[model samples]
Target: MSANTEGFKTFWEQLTPERVAHIGEYYTDDAYFRDPFNEVRGLPAIRKIFDHMFVQLHEPRFTILEVVHQGDTAFFVWDFTFRMKSYKPEVVQTIHGSSHVRFASDGRVSYHRDYWDAANELYAKLPVIGALMRWLAKKMA
Candidate 1:
């Protein structure tokens, strides 16, 4: 990995509440990101999203499986693990996802996007929709 990509990987792997508050080092002021639920712009807005995610998921953490970079962009293959805020002790629920990042001339991210099968990684793991989704997914497969 190039020095810049290595820097990005280090930033992501070490992300935490305190680090997110200082995301200006990693993202531009007008950076934009789109994912399943929302389209957000600016580092402050992005920080809010991350803040909420970390709050709602206990022990939230990312495990980097791979980092692939080409020129000014990179993809992080990762697995996220956490117990949902509403999780009961008897049940287990964890979320796994990945993100793609595009860098600007200053080495801060200009655009970011995430990829993951929401049905399988999130919705299908829910209590109500899980069983039905599992059934349909199996049928479709």
Candidate 2:
């Protein structure tokens, strides 16, 4: 296992509200991170995003499925499982996605971007937007 990939696996596997302080160990000071609903630079801003996640969701977790590394860049596929705090029945939602990570010279992540289908993975799963998205998909089809 490459240093970058190993570090990523370890970091994410142990991620939690309390463990977030370790983000600096894996990400450089000037790291850039982005996903479907967020684009932020630096650790402080990135940490806020994570803090918000724990506050908004119930039992959110990520399971890495695959990892491919080449030079300084690595791609990882993962399954993100979580439930909304407001949902009573406690149905777990899973979003399968991939991430592109570029490691800095020191092996810390410098650039991180996640690739996922928002319409299908997130928006289409919402209570109101889900119905509309499904209807639109059917109509378009």
Candidate 3:
């Protein structure tokens, strides 16, 4: 395995509220990050995103499924599992997604972009909005 891939996998699989503060160890100070819901640059903003994840979800965890690396870029396919802290806390939810990361010269992540289907993976799991999203999907299909 590439050094970047190994480091990233370890960082993500072991992430926690406490570990969120250690983001700078893996990401550059000016790193860019984007996902279905957020787009932010810099370590502080990136850390906030991760901090919010722990606050909004119950026991959120990531499981790496695959990794592909070439040059300074690595792509990771992963599964994120968690339960909503407020709604159906007992029901476990999983989202399949992928991240593309580019490593800086110092081996820290300089750019990271995540791809996922929020409508199907998240909005469709909500209480009221779920119904609407499902109906819309059916109609569109």
Question: Going through the candidates in order, what is the number of backbone clashes in each?
Answer: 0, 0, 0
Q: Judged by TM-score, which candidate is best? A: 3
- Candidate 2: tens digits of C-alpha lDDT, residues 1-141: 697789788788668998787789889998999999999999998888998989989888989999999999999999999898875438899899999999999999999999999999988878899999999999999
In model 3, how large is the Cα lDDT of residue 19? Answer: 90
List residue ranges in candidate 1 displaced over 4 A.
Answer: 89-94, 138-141
Candidate 3 ranges with C-alpha deviation above 4 Å: none
Give all TM-scores, in the order shown.
0.89, 0.95, 0.98
Candidate order by TM-score, highest to lowest?
3, 2, 1
**Per-model lDDT:** 0.83, 0.90, 0.95
- The TM-score measured for candidate 1 stands at 0.89
Q: For residues 92-133, could you state the per-residue lDDT of candidate 1 as single tens digits? A: 565567788999999888998988778888887678899999
Worst 10 contiguous positions by lDDT, candidate 1:
87-96
> What TM value does model 3 have?
0.98
Task: Estimate, for each residue in 1-141, the C-alpha lDDT of model 3 and write its tens digit.
Answer: 788779899999999999999999999999999999999999999999999999999999999999999999999999999999999999999999999999999999999999999999999998899999989989999
